[model samples]
Target: MFEDKIEKMNENIGTIPMIEYEKRVYTPEEIQDILGVSRTTIYQLIKSKVFHSVRVGGQYRISKRSFDKWLEESDEEL
Candidate 1:
């Protein structure tokens, strides 16, 4: 059912190639690597809600969507 819906969506939105969507979840380590921020500062950002994160089990994971949006917003200012 879901596959059929996706196929219909693709047909309706034709002419433009559809790239497969990526799973955009990021770990704290990945976020730190991307942002080049300290682990302490990462925690602060997560705590202050400057970075968007989802809690799973015992770890909090950041969303790649939030990071991409942040990059776009910052780029617009420059």
Candidate 2:
């Protein structure tokens, strides 16, 4: 069924299909859980640019790199 169709498509294209993986992006909900904080606090941090984030649709996504940088700097500041 699905596998056969994929094989046929691959045969026609003559190239192995590359698996697509979603980029690791963290949502505010996950951040809140990780930091053990409220959503409002997360939003506040985002507003202050403590974490690098981009608005996708109505939600925000924080880059893992940006979050890691913040964590490292915050630790040094402590």
Tens digits of per-residue lDDT for model 2 on 6-63? 9888787747668898667899999999899998999999999987999999989999
Point to the candidate with the largest lDDT: 2
Model 1, range 1-78, lDDT digits (tens) per residue?
999999888897757867898878888888789889899977887888765898999998888888678768888999
The CA lDDT at 51 in model 1 is 52
Output the lDDT of residue 38, model 1.
Answer: 94
Best by TM-score: 2
Judged by whole-model lDDT over C-alpha atoms, candidate 1 comes out at 0.83
Report how far off residue 49 is in candidate 1 (Å): 0.8
What is the Cα-based TM-score of model 1?
Answer: 0.63
Positional deviation of residue 42's Cα in model 1 after best superposition, in angstroms: 0.9
Clashing pairs in 1: none
The worst-scoring run of ten residues by lDDT in candidate 1 lies at 9-18
List ranges where model 1 is wrong by over 4 Å.
Answer: 1-21
Q: Estimate each model's TM-score.
A: 0.63, 0.69
Error of 1 at 27 (Å): 0.4
